[model samples]
Target: MAAPPEKKTLRIGVLYEHTQMTDLAGVDILGNMSTKSVNLVATLEPRVSALLPLSTPMEFLYISSTLEPSWTTPDMFVKPTHTYANAPRDLDIIMLGGPDPAAAHEDSITFLKKASKQTKWILTTCTGGMWLARAGVLDGKKATTNRMFVAKHAGEWFPKTEWLDQRWVVADGEFEGAQIWTSGGAGCGESYVSNTR
Candidate 1:
């Protein structure tokens, strides 16, 4: 009998910005897609666990401005494993997540510009889209964000990107290489994950 094929691992870099707990939901679901689904089955049929690959489909590196730890929301706090200066350059997926409408700092914008070149997918939630715009990655792409917020303030922030007023999530570009996934609100991050490969 041959061993199960090694699972392909996706390296995910989730950006941590201030006051944006909802944005984290996007990466959280992707990171758990395999484990969460399989764990339940393994509980029902314990033998199945041994046959399945132990390797996770996704590996996450939380990237933030500091290693000192910070609050993402009123109730959520995260201690990032990697800082912008030290994060791996070759990332499979990069998520610009966090609270909406917050201005992207120079360091974050610089990192996004560099990472976008090598990253396959870029997922942004709520006002996180603003950061991508600042990085110039969404210059010609059709994207969406928190509808209400975008209507009021996004124009000045993301003038280059074609902002849309529609539903929860909108996607542009090919999934195999470079793609942008933008979700409206915090809860919509799940929709972004479900639609993506």
Candidate 2:
């Protein structure tokens, strides 16, 4: 009998910040790609942590940005497994998200710009797209953010990229070394649901 080819393991990193829970959770959807071989690591800035609600008494636990932790709210809080400074440089995919466009802008740009150079794929949702734009990762790429927000403000921030309308998700071509996937608000998946019905 001939031997089968060995499967390649993918290292996936998801960026995290306070109040940016939705899109971070959305990153889990990527697990569908190959759960058995895909390793998902949530990355954060130095000295930063992700806080999430508790089941009893409404408490919160501060998880180390570089250690794997359990999640109290499966749908809301995703405990990080690494800090940006310590995350794997050979990540195959990187996901970016924040509660607002400006959150962690300056602190994350330097690291993001460097990581994007080696990452094979970049997936961003909502204002998370803004972080990639600010990092110049989206330059010369066609992408989209939350329509409500982009309709009024994205142009001022991403003048080099082409912003499109009338869609739930906009996929752009490879730039440098990464393929970019961006979507409207966190509710973008919902649009697919409506279309399917």
Candidate 3:
């Protein structure tokens, strides 16, 4: 009898602080794909052969500068699973949601600069691309952010990056060995994730 395919765990770090929850729609889709409920359904229903869970397992790390809960809005928050200093160094993917550009801390930016070089993929939604630009990873790379932000501030803030006015943009070329995937406003993040899948 042949052996089953090995399942490798995909570690994804979600970097956020004061980020809009809607900006993380794509990550949520990925999470759904990795859920046990879907896997159970796929295994039990032979007739629904098309319904399959992700081939590899997935682990999500909610990262923040500190262990404290990070606010998504005034009343809602997500607790950090790991801090920048202690988070695993070898992550397969790093996901970023739109946060206030000026509110990003130097430590978080530094962590991103290091993570970008080691991670296989960097997915950003809305102003998250701006954070990558702040880390100097997006310089000389073609990326897209929220269209409103692109028109008003992205160009002036990150002149080195070629910002585009699109719903989503994929820069397949390696930026320190990581491919960047960026998307504009709400719901577009989900679109980007669908394309990747």
Candidate 4:
């Protein structure tokens, strides 16, 4: 009998600080794409059984500038699994949700600059693209942000980037070999994730 192939784990680094909860909704969908969910679907349908082994297991590392909890709202927050300085270098994906652009920390911007080179994908929701812009990762890249922000400040603030008026933009240029994806305002993240899947 042949042995099963080893499962590949998809490491995702979720960066957050004063992020909007709605912007992070796509992470939940990503969490549901694990091997366990694939098995459940196979059991329920009895089809796609042969494709179950192709599903990659996913691991999410909630990252913050500090070890303390990161607040998404005045009442809600998410604890950090790792700080920017100590996060794993082998992240497959770097995900960011909308946070107050003015409140962005220098450390976070620095981390994004470094991580973008190593990660396969960089995903941003709403104003989260601002951090990438501040990091200079979005410079010369075709990207989009919250529609309101794109119309008002994205162009003026980040003139180097080609800001587009769209629900979301997926730029697959050689950004240190990373594909960048940016989604507009709240709830657009859900559409982005679903379409990407």
Question: Global lDDT of each model?
Answer: 0.73, 0.57, 0.81, 0.82
lDDT of 3: 0.81
In the range 55-95, model 1's lDDT, one tens digit per residue, is: 26777888877887856786677888988888886787888
CA RMSD, predictions in order = 3.1, 11.6, 2.5, 2.8
- Segments in model 4 whose C-alpha atoms lie over 4 Å from true places: 36-54, 173-177, 194-197
lDDT of 3 by residue, 1-197 (tens): 97767767789899868788888877778876764546766678755435543444789899999989888954688999999888885788888889887778778888987887778888899899898889888888899998898976999998999999988888863545557898888667777665554
Kindly list the per-residue Cα lDDT of model 2 for residues 78-143, writing each as its tens digit: 565666666665566666654456655364677678877776766677777777788887787787
Best by TM-score: 3
- The TM-scores of all predictions, comma-separated, are 0.83, 0.67, 0.88, 0.87
> Model 4, 49-69: lDDT tens per residue?
766766678888999999898
3 or 4: which has the higher lDDT?
A: 4
**Candidate 3 — number of clashing residue pairs?**
0
Residue 83 Cα positional deviation in candidate 3, in Å, after optimal superposition? 0.6
* Candidate 2 structure, TM-score to reference: 0.67
Once fitted onto the true fold, the runs of candidate 3 whose alpha carbons sit more than 4 angstroms away are: 40-55, 173-177
| Residue pairs in candidate 4 whose N, alpha carbon or C atoms collide under 3 angstroms | none
